[model samples]
Target: MLTVGLLGALVEARRSLELSKPKTQVQWVDLAAPHGPVDLALRLLGDETPAPPSIDPGLVATWDHIPDHGAVDRMLQQALVNAYGFVVGYTDAMHQVCRWIQVLAHPMTQTTNVRALLVGPTGVGKDLVARTVARLGRRASQPFVAINCATLPRELIVAELFGAEAGAYTGLARRRPGLFQAAADGVLFLDEVSELPLELQPVLLRVLDEHAFRPLGSTTQIAFHAQIISATNRELASLIEGGAMRADLYYRLAHVVVPLPSLAERADDLDLLVRYLWRQVDDSDPPEDIIAEVARRAWPGNIRQLRGVIERAVLLRKTVGSTSSLLDEIKAAPAAQPVPSGTLSELRQRFERDVLVSIVQRCGGNIRDIARELGITQRSVYNLLKRHRIAPGK
Candidate 1:
């Protein structure tokens, strides 16, 4: 019995020593240095090595906060975020959205209708912003109708926006009020505004000009009092250039433009966002280990993607029964290899090229959407296309 006890103690000490040894020999790079997040990530991971001690809980806890601006309209901003569920990050890009939301709170004259546009990458909460704006408006009790223009068939889009009379088309057995008519004295949120068919652009422009739309097979016009709020992942300027959108229509729809940052752009908000999303998926408090792991990733799909992954993690936790095991499972999963490093300019160019390619692929080679997602002017996007020799069609 004495020999067996001694043997068990010796084995435990050996296990502890093995665990204490560094798993990978990696050099540290100041994350706040001039390097981009991608570069910093590469340096941290170094040639198939495990992520270093940077995954510490303390690192996850240290995130920059939005500083107090003495006279900022923080009440309205907080109300929109907390009450209305408009989760924004601390990045300057997202702060700009907050500023715009605050501006939206100002009372508008009865005669002057509000028209707002939200532009950003897909799933960056454009719809959330539009809905929140509607809730914030004077017509909060009235209907807030939302439509995805892209999902509608081109033949049905016009009818959907401006209702059709009975027997107006093959499918029309009865007259139905359009979205604009339904949202009377309220808000009409047109998500994917760029997808509004080119043939119907003039009709929309006319409605914006006169606040009236003509139903199919009807000579009389129906008056519309609904405010218009649009969200899109595409650029109107490029769309206009391509003759798929109208400049006049763009002028009417974009009275106020608010752009949101991608999730990766606001890395500091990862912990906050993760914690918020975890509570949404589970009743328990957010586990620090999961938050740390999530922070280390590059969430290309932005907030929507982050939320989805966390929800899945929460689902897995039910079976795994502990945060540590879930994290171990995540670590065991295969991850993509990093791009090789080159000179500084080369790295920048490579990153730029990669971003352009990725956006183009995701958008199916729509330059307008690419420009919008990259937050660059269409002209700059064209210039990059020329420099990188990337054809817009793939």
Candidate 2:
């Protein structure tokens, strides 16, 4: 009876524990029975862990909206591309210019008085050659000031050459510097040196002699430290003989005279120069036939004329979209055709007669264009017609 009572107490305790505990689901099968018995149990668990948040759409959109390059950036990139495509050709004159530049850049040459003069026909790239030399020299960083003496009148030439102090003249309110002083420690390119007034020649001579000058109305003398490069289309020797240029100044300026070949002389460079300018247009290589045609032409105006023709051709190509036949068109142009064969003297006389007739015809028997074109001070267009014995509108 005591054993039965102990068993009943144990069964009661197990029933109470099961009622207090949380239930968990579990599945089980009884091994002893043929039919399986399955049981399910459930137990309490902690809250679920959170996942990472997604990125904001606006931030992603903002990054995608930014451009890889801006307008100005694109322009600069194109310019660089065009510049790299620019082909500078090798010629005897070009080689000379390069040699001069190399000599100028030499350590010993910079401190010496090395003056150079460029003599060539109009539009033959004399100024360009001088500037190129300056660009490649040791003084590349220095200022390069170019002055055309022929463009300035005689009265103002002095002030332009040497600076004036404030109140030096009626127009002088503020103290100003001249080209020589302005080009201090740099280069001063004097174009049309033969056109400089005879009176002002002394001032230039003094500068070359003393390397010093006084501005207008200033008692103090200022020292000028600069290289001088002068260019002229006129024959310096003839100008000196004609009393237009001082003989002493001519000698001083002509220490090294670089005679630039005309465009006709370097017809080979025409195509190269044309292609260069073409590439500059839109960074696109022109058709080979166009370049060949350009090379075939005898550019009368030299580089300048070549540039103009190429520019027109480029514009036409852009509009018409056909460059294959450009050569024939260029060859057919009036200027491209060669003049009839003649001796040098015969050619000059014929050209002169033709020019005189054209002038007379255009002026209605007046000579204004011929006079102005020839840069003569006294002769009028009518006077030229009278001298040439040509009738107008005949």
Considering every candidate listed, which one attains the maximal lDDT?
Answer: 1
**Residue 297 C-alpha lDDT in model 1:** 69
lDDT tens digits by residue: candidate 2, 112-219? 858888887788776766665556456768888898888986776777789889988887889989888988887788998888878889988998999899898899
| Model 1 superposed RMSD (Cα) | 16.9
Q: 1-394 in candidate 1: lDDT tens per residue?
A: 1111111232332233234323322221333211111112112122244444545533321101224321122322232254345665445666666556545543572227768889888878988877766665566778989999899878787788888999989977999778888889888889998988778888999999998999877888999998888888975765676467888998899888887777756776777678667767687756777887777766667788778778878887787775665677556644423435687478657877897888989988887888788655678778888989999889
Quantify all predictions' global Cα lDDT against the true fold.
Answer: 0.66, 0.60
RMSD of 2: 31.8
Candidate 1 yields a Cα-based lDDT of 0.66
Residue 65 shift from truth in candidate 2, angstroms: 40
My TM-score estimates for the predictions, one after another, are: 0.65, 0.62
TM-score, candidate number 1: 0.65
TM-score of 2: 0.62
Candidate 2's displacement at residue 39, Å, is 90
